[model samples]
Target: MDKNQLGVQYMQEGNWEEAAKAFNDAIEENPKDPVAYINFGNVLSAVDDDEKAVKFYQKAIEIDEHAGAAYYSIGNVFFTQDRFTEAKKMFETAMKKGLESSDNFFMLGLTLVQLNQGKLALPYLQRSVELNEHDAEARFQYGLCLAQLELIDEAILQLEKCIELDPDHSDAFYNLGVSFAFKETSVKAIEMFNKALEIQPDHLLAGHAKKLIENNL
Candidate 1:
C-alpha cells in the first residue's frame, strides 16, 4: 500500500507512533500532499497534543485551502476543548469546502447543540442520519433534538430506530420513555423506563421518572 494508506491503517489499529512515522514518510515523499499533513494531525490529536495537531492541520490548510478534512480535524480538537463557536466555524468551513461526510455533519450539529442552538442543529443532524442510517448515536441525537423541539412523534420514531440499531443503549430507552410519557401513553412509557433500567440499573432519570409515574398512578 502507499504510505498514506499505510498510515491510515496504522491509525485504525490505534498505533499512533507508526501512523505518525508513516505519515512523516508520506510528507517527505510529497511535501505538498495535504492528506499526509492531515493524517499526521490526526495522529497528534489522538495523542492529546492539541496544539501540535492544530499546527499540522493548519499546515495542511496552507498547502491546500480546499482541504476539508484538515478543517474537520481542527474542528474535532476544538470540540473536545469545548470551544463550541470555533468548532462550529471549522465544521461550517469543512462543509463549505465540500466535506459532505456524515461525521462532519454530525459534529457540526453537535456543536450547535453545545451552543444551545438545538433548533439550528436539527437539519444537520437529520442530514447526518440520512447519510448514515446505521449510526445509532446520530439517530439518538436527532431524536433528542426533536424531543426538545416538542416533536414527540418524530422523536419517538428516531429513538426507536436508534434502539433497534443498539439495543444496549440505555439512554435511547430512557429517551423513548420520555417521548411516550409526553404522548400520555403511560403504560408504554413505564415499559420503556423498565427496559432502560434493565439495561442500566443506575439510570437516574429512568428511575426517577418511573417512580414519579407510579406515585401519580
Candidate 2:
C-alpha cells in the first residue's frame, strides 16, 4: 500500500535493500514522520548496523519527542553493544514515554542484572513475568536474580515456572537442581539434574552435579 507499509513487509521478508528503499521513500515523502525514521532504524538494526540505526532512532526522537519505540530501539542497540548503563537509561526513558512491551521491561531488568543490581532488577523482572508469563527467558532471568539475592525458595518457583513454560529449557532444570541443593533437598536436586541431562545428554555441569548428589555429597 504505502511506502511505510511496504517497508515493513520488506523488513519482515528479510530484504534489507528493498526495505531501506521503501523507508527512504517514506522519509523523502515526509521528513517529519517519526514512524518512517523508526522503520528505517529497524532496517538498519536488522542488518547489524547499530551505529547507523542509532542515528535513525535518534532522529525519530527529535521528530517526535515521545516516540517510545525510537527510545526502545536505541536501547536495544546499546544492549547489543554491552553498554548496559546507557541501555538502562534508554529503556527507562521508553517506559516513561509509555512503551509497555513486556520485552522492554525484561531488557531493563536484564540490564540491571548485568550491572549487578539484582535488587533493583527484581521489580522490573517481576513486572515482565506478570505481563507475559509464557516468556521462559524472562522467568529464567527473574529466577536467576532471585537466586543472586539468596531468595532460594522464590527462585525455585520462578525456575519451575520457566520449566513449565518451556519443558526443554535445560538451564532452568540445571538451575532448579542447584536451588534444591541449596535447600538441602538432595533427592529433588538429583532429580532436576537428571532431568536436565535427559533433555541435554551433554550437559556437563548437570552430569557433574548428578554424580555428586548420587554419592550423597
Candidate 3:
C-alpha cells in the first residue's frame, strides 16, 4: 500500500511516531498533495503539537484552498486553545468547503455558545443532534441552547432524550430539573433533581436544587 495508507494504519493502531514518519514519507512522495499535508497535520494534532499542526494544515490550504478537513483541523486546535473567534471562522470556512460531520457541527455550535451567541448556535446544535441522535452530550448541549431561548418544551425533550440514552448522565437530569423548575413544575423538578442526585450523590447543585424545591413546595 501507499505511504498515506500505511500512515493511516499506524494512526489507527495508536503508533504516533510511526504514523508521523509514514505521513512524512507520504508528503515527500507527493509534495503537492493537499491530502498528504492534511494527514500529516492530523498526526501532529493527535500528538498535541498544535503549532506544527497549523503549519501543515496551512500548507494543505496553500496546495488546495478548499481543503475542508484542513480548516476543520485548524478549528479544532484553535477551539482547544479557547480562541473561539478564530475557531468559529475556520469551522465556518470548513462548512463552506463541504465539511460535514456531527463533530464539526457540535464544536461550531459549542464555540458559538461560548462566544455568548447561543441564538445563532441553535441551528448547528440542532443539526448535530439530528446527525447523531444517540450522542447524549450533544443532546444536553442542544437542550441548554433551547432553554436559553425559552423553548422550554423543546429543551425538556432533548434533556429527556439525553437521560434515556445515558441514564447515568447526572447533568442531564439536573438540567431537566432546572427546566421544569423554570416552568414552575415544582414536583417534577424535585423528582428530576432527586434522580440526578441519586445518579451522582456528590452533585452539589442537584442536592441543593432538590432541597430548594421541597422547601418551596
Candidate 4:
C-alpha cells in the first residue's frame, strides 16, 4: 500500500508514532506531497508538538496554496494558543478556500463567542445548528449566542431543542434553566435545574441554578 494510505491507517488506529513515521517516509519519497505534510502535521499536533506541526502545515500550504486542511490545522493550533483572532482568520480563509464543513462553522462561531463577538458569531453558530440540528453542543452554543443577543425566546427554543436531542445533556438543561431565570420564571428554572441534576447528580451549574431558584422563591 502507498505510504499515505499506511499513514492514514496508522492515524486511525491511534498509532501516532507510526503515523508520523509513515507520513515522514511519504514526504521523503515525494517532498511535494501536500497530503503527507498535512498528515504529518496532524500526527505532530496529536503528540502536542504544535511548533513542528505548524511548520509541516506551512509546508503543506506552500505546496498547495489552497490546502484547506492545512489552514484548519493551523487555525486549531492558534486556537489552542488562545489567539482567537488569528484562529478565526485562518478558519475564515479555509472556508473561503472551500473548506466548508460543520466543524469549520462551529470552530469559527466558538472563536467569535470567545472574543465576545457573539453578534458576529450568531450566523455561523446558526449555520452549525442548521448543518447538524441533532448536534447537542451546536444547539447549546446557538442558544448561548441568541441569549447574548437578548433573543430570549429564540435562545429557549434552541436550548429546548438541544435537550430534546440529548436528554442527558446536563449543560443544555442548566442553560435552559438560566434562560428561564432570565425571564423571571423561577419555577420553570427550578424544574429544568432539577432535570439537570437528575441526569448529572454532581452538576455544578445545576446546583447553582437550584440555589438561585430558592433565592427567587
Q: Please report the candidate that would top TM-score against the real structure.
A: 1
User: Model 3 over residues 1-217: C-alpha lDDT tens digits?
Assistant: 9999999999999998999999899888789999989988998989889899999999999999999989999999999999999999999999999988888899999999999999999999999999999999999999999999999999999999998999999999999999999999999998999999898999999998888888888
- When summed lDDT is taken over every stretch of 10 residues in candidate 3, the lowest stretch is 208-217
- TM-scores for all candidates? 0.98, 0.92, 0.91, 0.91
Evaluated at residue 155, the lDDT of candidate 4 is 97
Q: After TM-score superposition, what is the CA distance of residue 100 in candidate 1 from its true location, in Å?
A: 0.8
Q: lDDT, candidate 3, residue 203?
A: 96
Show the colliding residue pairs in model 3: none
So what's the TM-score on candidate 4?
0.91
lDDT of 4 by residue, 1-217 (tens): 9999999999899999899889989999999999899999999999899999999999999999999989988999999999999999999998998988888898999999999999999999999888887788899899989988999999999999988888988888888888899899888999999999999999998898799679758
Give stretches of model 1 more than 4 Å off: none
- In candidate 3, stretches whose alpha carbon ends up further than 4 angstroms from where it belongs are none
Local error of candidate 1 at residue 76 (angstroms): 0.8
Query: What local distance difference test score does each model get?
Result: 0.96, 0.95, 0.93, 0.91
Runs of candidate 4 with Cα error greater than 4 angstroms are none
Give all candidate RMSDs, comma-separated: 0.7, 1.7, 1.8, 1.8
- Worst lDDT 10-window in candidate 4: 208-217
| Deviation in Å, model 4, residue 182 alpha carbon | 1.9
List clashing residue pairs in candidate 1. Answer: none
User: Candidate 4 clash total?
Assistant: 0
- Model 1 over residues 75-175: C-alpha lDDT tens digits? 99999999999999999999999999999999999999999999999999999999999999999999999999999999999999999999999999999
